[model samples]
Structure formats: structure tokens, C-alpha cells
Target chain A: MDVYLPIAEVSVNAPLLLALGALVGFISGLFGIGGGFLMAPVLVFLGIPPAVAVASQANHVVASSTSSVLTYSKAGSVDYRMGGIMALGGAVGALFGVELFRLLRLLGQADLVVAVSYLLLLGSIGALTLKESLTTILARRRGEPARREPTRRPLWLYGLPFRVRFPRSGLYISAIPPLLLGVFAGILSAIMGVGGGFILVPAMVYILRMRAAVVVGTSLFQILITTAVTTVLQAGRNQTVDIVLSTLLMVGGVLGAQYGAKASARFRADEMRAALGLLILLVGLQMGLSLFLRPDDPFALAPGGAG
Target chain B: MMVPPGPPPMDPPALVAPAPEPPGPVVVTQTPTISAALTNSEIEVDSSYAGASLVLYGAVFNPGDDPVDVVLVVRGPERPVRLVRKVRVAGLWLNSRPVVFEGAPAFYVMASTRPLSEIAGFGVLRRMGVGLDHIQIDAPDEARTVNLYGVRDVVISRLGEDYLEWRRAVIRLKERDGLYRADPSGVRFVDPGLFRAEIVLPPEAPTGEYRTEVWLFQNGQAISVRRNTIQVRRVGVERWLHNFAFFQPWLYGLVSVLLAGFTGWAASRWFRRT
Candidate 1:
């Protein structure tokens, strides 16, 4: 039952690992989020070193997104041109994010940064999603149409230079906005050790106002590349990725995703959003509580510690 | 410490009686000789490698009809250790300060027939550097160790006033991870003047050279000491990957990405075909 993870240099229960992967993958399929945010924290809670957990989870993200991207491509939902431009910006942002990650680690404040960021991102995102879902549900009961505001581009974003046309999204917006959005997501992807799909999907849908059909697939395509970049960088620079751990997780993730995708149609969209919001809220609360609780033993040894 | 009624030690002519400590006098007469050997001198870690139990056996050469005690210390490689002290800041436990410890061992385990205090005096243990309390932490020469009581900024609690507390915290962390252990009654005698102890290494133990030392004591004073070294390393695929990760990290990273991508692609195709 015990298997040695080479990079982690630790023995872990194989079955337990498979189960954890399945759970994360199921959520990934159900919600269409990259699941990196969920996987990293859970792995840390399960006693994997933070660095290893981040690196290995990045690898798993690449795998899951790869499969999903292929399906999206077949469905003619992917916007390759937009995905490529964002990827270019994302690459630059990821490089900067890696350096920032290294700096925080050197300051011996990496854990603090991770915990605080998780709390802020999860708390705000969860609250917003819950609020939106509730409003939509209540509006439907009263036989009212969903509120639609006149699409007004922010003046600052509109005036930015280097305007480009995205035919699929039917927008001739300035390239700066999409590129900047990609950069923000990429930076978050590296710092959070996730694929950034949760942030990306929203940014594409609302900020750029892309078609809903294009949003999920284009975002998945971008995640596949960004996380692929993350995996290589973490492994090459930090040497924290555990191949065995990632592989085991990927196995269960694929199967769980299959079942999750099949069951997605069974639930209403609002109900699914509410469930995801609740899940995120609970995870955020736990992380918030940890920040206020004193650890029993604070001394730690790291082989590649703040060197 | 008991001697069964059996034939006396073969070398009776050299049987020297225990004597009082003297100032630079002939302490050789009361010196108790000891020897030790580990069951395994090399540990190979493979895919199925979980953990290993190592046995170290030794005997007090000059029994001399006197009851003697043995203490065994097995220590792993030395590494720099860091400890963080969390302080409640605005109702949140923030990592307010950090303590850096130099020359902390990666793994440490000690066992003796009886409690170390009963076997040897504090000075003796201190001289031998066997007990946990007696560990020598190399403090920086410039900084005279400081304590934490809300200094102007985040305080770095180095080795000085709060040294003991920091050291205890280190031990607690190691024990929680199953890396450090102190078993007072772990060692036992297989026969009169002969003793053996088990040094258990968890599967997560760092691969490095480990030192096992045995200290011989008579009349509650150390007489002699012997040491042995064991090597732990990875073998097979684990070894290959470990070497690749450290030596050619960029290539390893590329390979990891490619392999994961391939698996994902293949699995997707397979599931679709089904």
C-alpha cells in the first residue's frame, strides 16, 4: 500500500492518493475550473511538502486540461488566435510570478502569502458566485428576465493602444485588455500553483465579454499551456515535482472526470453554482481559521529551504 | 545492569577494578573497552522500500565483575534548521519571528538500557554530546542571542536566552514527523557484558550517511566510546529519477511535462474510443 514518491522522498498510501485525485478531478469536471486551487491545499493538508504539492499539482493540471482541450477543439469552441495571444502574455507574466514566488520563499514568508491569498481569493470569489446564483434563481421564480446592462466598455481600456479583432468573440477591442487579463491570471496561476481557470473563465466572460461557448474551451486551451509552462519551470528551477505522485493522481482524475462530466447535465446550472460556492466558502473558512491558530511546533527543516 | 553467574571474562589478568576519578592520573586502569557493529552497513532504497530496522550489537570488553551500561546514538546528516515563532497580531497568528539553528542533524535516535540520567552524569553526557539537551548549536559569533517580547520589529529568536525553548521545539517537530526518538529502555542485554539496540529508520528518512556511536559507562561515568557509520541511498528507478532531478533538472522537467501530456492525451483517446 505504501509507495515511495521519488521527488517527495516520502512514503504515501497509494489508494488514498488515488481517492484524493478522484475527488479533485470530479470537481474539475463538474465546475470546469482547473482545480489547482483545490488540489494544492488538499495536498498540503495531507502532509505533502508545500513545494512538492504545488509542483506535482501543476503537472496534474496539465494532464486534465489536455484531455478537456481536445474535446473542446473537436466541438469547434476553441479560439486558437485569442488563446495564442493570451499565452504569449501569460508566458511573460508566469516568469515574473516565478521570481515573486522565489522572493517570498527567500523571505520565509511563502506559507503566509499562500494562506492569505487563498483566504482572500476564495472568500471573495465564493461570495460573489453565491450572490449571483441566488439573484438569478430568485429572478426566475418571479418570471423576470435576468438583468442585462448595456455593454459599456470602460473608457480607459477602450483607449489603450494595439487594438486587435477577435472574430470568434465578435469584438474589435484593444489587445491590451485581453493581454493584461492574461498576465494577471498567469501571475496568479504561478503564485497560487494552479491553472488559473477559475480566474480566467470569469475574466474572459465578463471583462472581454466573450461568448459563453468560447469562454470555457478557450480558457481550457490556455490552461493547458500555462500549467504546462508551470510544470516545467517548477521542476527545472525548484526541482519539486514528483512524477510518481502526479501520475497516480492523473489516473484517478481521468476516470473521475468521465463520471463527473456525465453527471453535470443532471443538475441545474444555478444549483451547481450554489454547490461550488458553498464548497469554496467552506475551504476558505478553514484556511482563514488556520491563520489565527498557533502551530504546535514551529521549527521546520527544509532541504531546499530559504537558500 | 546484571552479570549472570557464568564463567568470568576470559581475560582475567587484565581485569582492572573501578577507581575514583583523578586529575590527569592513570584513568586507563578504569577504562571500559567497547565494540559495536550494525546489522546492515548499507541500505538500498527501491520502489517497494518502506523502512528498515537496524540492529547494533556491542559488548563491554572488560566486564571486571562490574555492572556497566551502554548508550547508543544514531544520528543522520547535519543540516541547517529553521523555526518560526507565531505571534497573535490583530487576532491572527502570524509568523512574527524566526530562529535559525546551525548544524542540526536530519535524523537522530538514542536508546539506552536505562534512563540516561541514571546511567551517566550530566557532565559525562555533555562531553559525549549524546543526550538531546546537550546538542551543540553553533551560534553566530556577532549576535548575542536575543529573546522575543515584541521588539521594534519581527524578532529573530536565535540561540541565547530562548535557546532551550527553541531546541525543544525542534525536537517536538522532529518527533511529530517520526524522525527523532528517545527510548530510555530500548537497549537490552542479550547476555552478560553484551548489549544490542534497534535503530528504526522510517521510509521517509533522508538518504545520507548515518553515524552510530556507543558509549560505555561504569560507576556512572563514561569510560570509552566507539562509532560506526551506515550509508543509505536509493537504487533502481528511484535512484535514476533522483539523479536526474538533481543533475539534469531542466531535462527532467521537460520529460515530466511530456510524459504527463502523453498520458493525458492517450487516456482521453482511449476513453473516447470506448
Candidate 2:
């Protein structure tokens, strides 16, 4: 069944919508990334108004992260102290990001901001991830052992107060890394309408040098808090949270995520990264092409931008 | 004096008896004479009715000897509301006196009562059918007439054994320079899952047979109403192209699928590690 939005006066195909949610969910589950980067572009391509699409993507992240967090907590992988500090910093960043978005919109530059941001971020991330994966694969093929280096905790972070010991990650790192990561995630989350899982996973593994086992759980915890706040903010301020659309997507995504997770375990880590990198590149190219192509006419009464 | 009176009375009585013999055999003759003839009246109308503009026309007929008055009535349901009303006749509004009324949803004609002798030459009383009812009045006597026109609120009455069933459908109308334009707008229920209703019209639709199918659904069971004709005609090239492009569903679906597949594939590849 299709549910219509009275305010937007738009009709969405429920099953197709759910499938989209599932695809995003699977990517998030497999890569330990919040699938927001993919969600915004897909929503626009599907003819959803850009503002509504971004807002709705943030809403979906709330659901996706909440579910993932529950699983992580059950496994005792979450760093509560670290997550708390990060969340506090993230809330501040989110508010600032939203204000910036509003300012850009007022200047009649929302579309330009969205397009530029997506192109720059996705292009850089895609190129970097592809390079790393290819280099790792080529190195492995040469039968040379991969180099492992211990990350040195910065002196300033250690000198700062609130030193936390995470037994699972086997580290006594300062709360500064998690805090900064949270703020960065929040800013990106607000702009991109994602839970910031994609950025968070890499930051934890490479920058913070957290154990692989703890990275997924820690990122999910941060995502849960950040996305929950984003959802409420979007609801209270913009009133863009659509319960019906979100529910339909969640129903499909939850099931699809389970299946994708099972399938992902069979693939090697490098293979998954390479696949994800290619996917991001393709989506970025499509978005770029849309700028030059004539857009399809939206058939609904009272389309966006009137307000 | 008595003898003179009796002579006079006798002379008068004799004359009176001769006169009273017969009241001139009362002649009751039945003549086969044409008292009145039913003359065919012509209905005339304008090119188009745009948003409550008055559609002007007249009914011309000759009533022999007897004076007759005509009453105009149109019938349709209150639902899917449309109202047509009468107004002043075109060109002769100042000189002619006419009756006006609220238009109805069905086919109706203008009639008037006047002596045939009074109707010298062509007696044309301009009539008006005005409203959103979209009732096209055919003026048979106009310089250019529309043979087939789009009709609104067409009630399809089903003749059942016990009770009558009625369903309302909009008729697509087109007309060209006094000719009938074939209508291709026919209703269809394309998607069963979504219960999406569509009206399909073809580009090459001519002044011929155009069937409409309205599927009635109750309790998830669909009953088909088939072979409903909506007359189409030549309204010119512009109208033909307009009708043709209205029902291109395949084009939309094709584009949607292609874009979706490409994006989905790209995203998967981009995010994947070697």
C-alpha cells in the first residue's frame, strides 16, 4: 500500500521505498557505515524534493542506528564513557550545522551547496578508498606481509582531562579523540542527512586506532545518539520526519540488513571496501550528470520551493 | 273582424308549416384534412464553453395553426456535480425575449410554442446552455457545426432484472468545423496493487469507434464494463498530439528503471573493496 503525504502532496510506492531502505541498510551493515551518503542521492533520483529527501534520510538513520546499537550493546562492545563525551560534542555541532544549512538556503544556494558537497566528499572518499583497497590487494598478491604500526596517542590528548581506558580496544586513550570524532560526525550528519557511520568507522579504525571488534559497536553507539538528536531536531523544527515512510523503509531494511550481514561475512574485508568504493564513485557521477540533464516534471500539486 | 283574423292566421300557418318541413337535413361531413404537421426543429450552438461562459443556440420550428410552448429539461445525478443554466441569446439579446434556466447533466433541447403562421421565413429564438456541465449543444443550422462533442456526466444505466444500476463516466469530446471528433480518453485500472486509475487516449484517434472500459471493484473482485463508445473527431493537429501524449506510461516506467539500475549498480561498485 502507498501512503501519501498531505503536506507535500506526494505519493510514494511503499514496496519500492522499502527496497531502497533495505539497500541502504545492507550497505551500512556490511561496511559499518551509516548509509546516508547513498540515501540522499537515491531519494533525489527517485524524484523526491531535495529538502524532503535530506530530512527523510536523517530520519531513516535514526531507525537504522537504533537497531544496530541494540545489537552492539548486547555484545558489550560500546564504550559508554567515550560515547557520552562524543554525543555531547555532537549535539552542539549538529545545531551549528543546521543553522548553516538554513543560512545557505536563505541565500538561495542550497542546491549548489548540496551538489558541491556531495561531489567533493564522495569523489575524494571514493578515490581514497579505491586506492587503499587496490594497494592492499596488490601487496597481498606479492606475498609480502602487511605492515602493522601502533598508533601513538597525541601528547595533547593525553595531557587533557578525562582519560578513558577501553579494555576491549586495549587502549587508554583520552576522551578528546572520541569527542572530536563525534563533533565531526554531527556536522556531516546534519549536512548529508546520514548517521555518519561511514566517516565514523574509518576514524575509529585508522585515526583512533580502535580494535576491529570494537569499531562497529562504538560507531553504532555514537550514531544512535547523534541520529536520535537529529531526528528530534528535524521533527521539532522542520517537521520533516514522516512516520509512515520511515516505517515502511525500516520494515524492509531490517530484514534485508540481516540477510546482508550474513552474506557479508563470506567476503574478504578488502573486497567489500573495493566494492563500496566503486559504488560511491558511480553514484557521484550520476549526481553530476543530473546537473546538466533536464529534470522530469513533478506531477504533484504544490511542489517544493513555494514556501 | 273574426273572419279577417282567421284568413290571416291560415296564410301564416301554411307558410310556417312549409318552412318547418326540415331543418335542411343536418349535413355532418367528415373531411380528411391536414390540421397540423409536426415540423423538425434545428438546434444550434457555439464553438466552446470556457468556465461558465454562456453557450448560445436556438431551436427553430413552425407550429401550424395551434400555439405551443416548449419546456427544456436536463437530467443527471447530484454527485460529480455540474450545473448548466440558460442565459441571453447571442447577437439578438436586445431584440429577442428568452427564458433562462440552470443547466442539467444530460442531453436536452430548446423548444418554444408559437403559431406556424407567425413563424415567417426562419424563426430563430436563441437559447443558452451555460455551466461546467460541459454539455455540448449541437446547432444543426449554424454555419459550422460540431457533429460529435464531449459530453459530461454520462450516466450508464444497467438494465437489471429487478433494479437499475447506474455508473457515471466522463466522455471525452472533440469537434472540428461542424464534424465529429473521435475521443480516445478511456478509463483503465492499470495497477491492481495500487489501484491506480488511468485514462488513455491515442494520437491517431479519428471520428470513429472508441471504446471505454471502466472496471468496477468490490471486495477485491473486479467487474468489467466494456465496449463503451466515446465519439472522437478532427479538432486539428494540436488536439490530436495533446491526446496522444497524455497516456504514455511506458515511457515513464522505462526511464525510471534505467536510472534506478544504473545508480544501484554504481553505488554497489563504488563502495566495494577490491
lDDT score at residue A278, model 2, on the 0-100 scale: 81
A136-158: candidate 1 lDDT, tens digit per residue = 78888899986784587567656
Q: Comparing only chain A of model 2 with the true chain A, what is the TM-score?
A: 0.88
> What's the lDDT for residue B18 in model 2?
22
Give the alpha carbon lDDT tens digit for every residue of B217-254 in model 1: 66676666677899998999999988998788888888
lDDT tens string, model 2, B212-245? Answer: 2222211111111112233433344323322332
Go through the candidates in order and give each one's DockQ.
0.44, 0.01
Relative to the real complex, the DockQ score for model 1 comes to 0.44
Alpha-carbon interface RMSD for all candidates, in angstroms: 3.1, 21.7
Q: In candidate 1, which residue ranges exceed 4 Å CA deviation?
A: A149-156, A298-303, B1-31, B144-157
Docking class of 2: incorrect
